[model samples]
Target: MSDTTAYSKKTMRVLLYLQQGELTEHQIYSFLASRVKDEQNSSVLRRIAGEELGHAKIWQKLTEKEVKTNRIKFWFYSLMALILGYTFVLKKMEKGEDKATKAYRSLITEVPQAKQISEDEDRHEQQLLAMLDEERLQYVGSMVLGLSDALVELSGTLAGLTFALQNTRLIALSGLITGISATLSMASSEYLSAKNSGDKNAVKSSMYTGIAYLFTVTFMVLPYLLLESYAVALGIMLVVVIIIIMFFTYYTSVAKDLPFGKRFFEMALISLSVAAISFVIGILVKRFLGIDI
Candidate 1:
């Protein structure tokens, strides 16, 4: 009996969904393979793209139906890969594959090829994904160092300054001066550390670190720069800090395969705790010194 004749309507629908997804992934991988500069990375992407096409063909044979690729998903992942780096986009796709793996396993009894497809999804794809080496990911340590230090130090500094100064302009001025100095310090420190460790990419690592630090500082200090009320600006700056933490933590989690919740909460706790401590100190200093701003 043929697959289309033997399967129910629901099963055929499932096969079609898987088929469309595979074809979309194939296109995304192929596009990335073409765009990637590294020869090895390009080869891996092309190989994966071929495998995805093969998977789509298997589904096509089972369903005996031609289905168009998902254009939206193709463009979305394509744009993301272009902007965020292919390693991140490919890792994110692995999460999607988990769902498809389950779907393939469900059809194993009805479709004999499902078993092999599921195994390939579980093993081969994962192995190939591990082979991808993107430069941005390699400097993740430097980026993390810059981001984490900026969050903890600047968040606390701004909180203290917000209370002590009680003027948005003054707070912003102090924060900018502090942030700029810290950015340079952090960048130079990273450069020296990388060089000392005999890393050939020392300059690149430091640049990433400096850029990450400066980016965080810009958002953290923006509210004070634009707003007149120090209290309101402080509130907004805290929100901005959380947002930055959330975004960076998510990116790292997706790209590095780390647990998101744990990393995010840890960073948030440290930054907020330091801010709270500094805020209290600001209040104490103002009271003890009898200096009215």
Candidate 2:
């Protein structure tokens, strides 16, 4: 039998699809590598790009067919790498390869190269990805500091104000004042902490922390600003806090190799627990002071 006849038609189609995918990924990775400022990260991305091209070449030998990379896919992922950090972009791409990996597994008997590529996907690519260093990830602790504090502190503050003020506009005003003050305080604290730790980018760390806190504060406060009922606004604010926690947890999980479910539940539990306690305290304070504002 001819070497080409060894592969079933289904196997040939799969090989062709893998060829196109690998070539497209190669271009995307190469483009991202060029766009990054960090030399180390650039080197890593370039290496991954080369490995992807090598995979494409292996498939080329099997099919004896040339496949062109998809320009549109390369451009789309390049845009994503530019907007979202490359860490997120790469991890998202890795997740997409799960389906391809399963398909390759099915063709391993007829295509030895498929088994090798699958192993590379599971071992080499994942290991290299774990070694990638992105600037945003370097300051993840600062972001966590800001995000956790804002979710816990602001949620509690809003809940307390909801009962104490009993008016949406008044509650929003009070929460804004408190949130602004806390944001500045948290930023200053993080700056000092980073500086004391001898971090060269202390200023940047503080900026990231402050920006994260400020964004969370703005989002959580928006419902109260827009709605007229304090109860409804408070309810919506809590929901927003949960969403922020979920997204951040997921992002951290993918970038840092942490577990999403545990992190998410822990953060949500703490933030909600604080808010619930503060809410009860607000009711007590309102009654004890005979306040009606």
Candidate 3:
């Protein structure tokens, strides 16, 4: 029935609204659950599914008669809407996941219900997440991690060395040296490392990651050229470098479809590991070669 007639028809009209709402919720759940795959969220989606199943019972109580023909029509419309909605939401949800990842740490903290969702919602979220993650791993190889790793390693190396030198030009040159050599080496290492893996996008991912990183270093090194005091410039550049790197990392995640939670942990771990290793190398050089501490 037309909406005008639907209004006057009966209380049974709620079934139409309820069914439409259930499908929309299903689409949302499919997207969300894919993003956050777990039993709890799955359970939520399943529960919503159950509620939908019982919705027919509510109809039976209210209408006291069968509307098999109408029910079929409703199912047909729901299915068609699902197809159209899935395609639309799939694209939007991936973007949404990318956007959400930027605030992942806070998003989780902010959305207490993030981990929780009804079955219909879970199914919707899950489908979206799956589509996103499929694109994500292609974008996220170990190379993204490696580039981030290189940023911390080279930045710290340049920072500490420039601190010791306390000469602006030399610091600038040092940073440049560090930037080029580190970029090439890291990119090469990542390329070779990824080459061994079967990921089709590994080479491409590493190539872009290295280029993005090379650019990030340029900014980190730029401050040294402007400032007179090497130590001061190094300190200031450290902050600048970190911010630039983070922006690139977050942006890369957006392009890659990486989830909010996974993205943060992955970025942090890769960077910290690189820093820790570099720190150890610095210590070893100091201990063995009597390099200036």
- Highest lDDT scorer: 1
Candidate 1's residue-wise lDDT over 76-162, tens digit each? Answer: 999999988999989888876777777887787788778877787668888999999999999898899999999999999999988
For all candidates in order, the CA lDDT equals 0.92, 0.90, 0.54
Look at candidate 2 and give me any clashing residue pairs: none
- Predictions: Cα RMSD each: 1.5, 2.0, 12.9
Local accuracy of candidate 3 as per-residue lDDT tens digits, 161-213? 56455567776887788788877777777777767876566667667667756
- The C-alpha local distance difference test score for the whole of candidate 3 amounts to 0.54
Give the range where candidate 1 is weakest over 10 consecutive residues by summed lDDT: 96-105
Worst 10 residues of 3 by lDDT: 99-108
Residue 118, candidate 2: alpha-carbon lDDT: 83
Cα distance off (Å), candidate 2, residue 209? 1.2
How are the candidates ranked when ordered by lDDT, highest leading?
Answer: 1, 2, 3
For model 2, where is the 10-residue window of minimal lDDT? Answer: 112-121
Model 3: lDDT of residue 66: 46
> Can you give the lDDT of residue 211 in candidate 1?
98
The alpha-carbon root-mean-square deviation between model 3 and the true structure, to one decimal in Å, is: 12.9
Identify the runs in model 1 with alpha carbons over 4 angstroms from their true place: none
In model 2, what is the error at residue 280, expressed in angstroms? Answer: 1.3
- Give per-model TM-scores: 0.95, 0.92, 0.46
